[model samples]
Target: MTASSSIGTGPGRALIAVYGLFSLAAGARATVQIAGRFQEAPLAYSLSAFAALVYIVLTVALWRGARGLALVALGIELAGVLVIGTASLLDPAAFPDETVWSAYGKGYLFIPLVLPVVGLYWLLRRRR
Candidate 1:
C-alpha cells in the first residue's frame, strides 16, 4: 500500500486505538457516576459525562479522518483539561469530587493531560 495508507495502518491505528480506550473508559465512568449517584455530586458527574462525550467525539473524528471535527474536539479537550485542572488545583471545594480532568487527569496517569497535545500534533500533521 501507499505511505499515507501505511500511516493509517501504524501510527494512525495506534492513535485510534488510544482514542478508543479513552472513549470506552470515559463513557463508562460517566455512565456510572450519572446513573448510580449523580445526586451526590451533580457538577462532578455532569463533568464526567461531558468529558466522556468529548472522548467519544475525539475518537470518532480521528478514526474517520474528519479534520475539522477532530480539531474542534481536541481544542475543547485541551481547554477543558486546562480550565478544570486549574480550578481543581486552586479551589478543591468547588469540585466536591473528581472528574476526569481533575488535577489535569492525574488519576489517569496524566494521559488526559497529554492526549490533547498529541492529538493536536496529529491533527496539525494531517493538515499538511
Candidate 2:
C-alpha cells in the first residue's frame, strides 16, 4: 500500500500507538494477575489476556495496512468490551477481579471502549 493509503500514517499512527500500548498494558496485567492469582479470578484474567491478543493483532493489522483484518479485530474488540462490561456490571460475582475490558475499561479511563470506534472510523474514512 502506498504511504498515503497506509493505516500507519497520519492519524492512524496514533491509533497504532494506542493499540500497541493497550497490547502491552493488557498483556502485562493479565500475566501478573494470572500468574499471581489465577484462582482469584480465572475468567477476568483470561479475558484480559484475550483482549491483549486482540490488541496485538489489531496493531499489526493496522501497521501492515490489512484493513479487513483490522476491521474484524476491531469488531471483536468492541463486542467484547460491550458484552464484558455489561456482564461485569450485571453480575459482578462472575468477575471477582477486573479484566482489561471490565466496566468498559473504566480503570483505563474508557479508552478500551472508545478505541475501536475511533479505529473503525479511521479505517473506513481512509478507504474512500
lDDT of 1 by residue, 3-49 (tens): 33333355667778888898888889888988988888888878888
TM-scores vs. true structure, each candidate? 0.90, 0.96
Q: Pick the TM-score winner.
A: 2
Q: Write the per-residue lDDT of candidate 2 for residues 31-109, one digit (tens) a residue.
A: 9999999999999999999999999999999988888899999999999999999999999999988899999999999
The CA-based lDDT of model 2 is what? 0.93
TM-score of 2: 0.96
Candidate 2 residues lying further than 4 Å off, grouped into runs, are 1-5
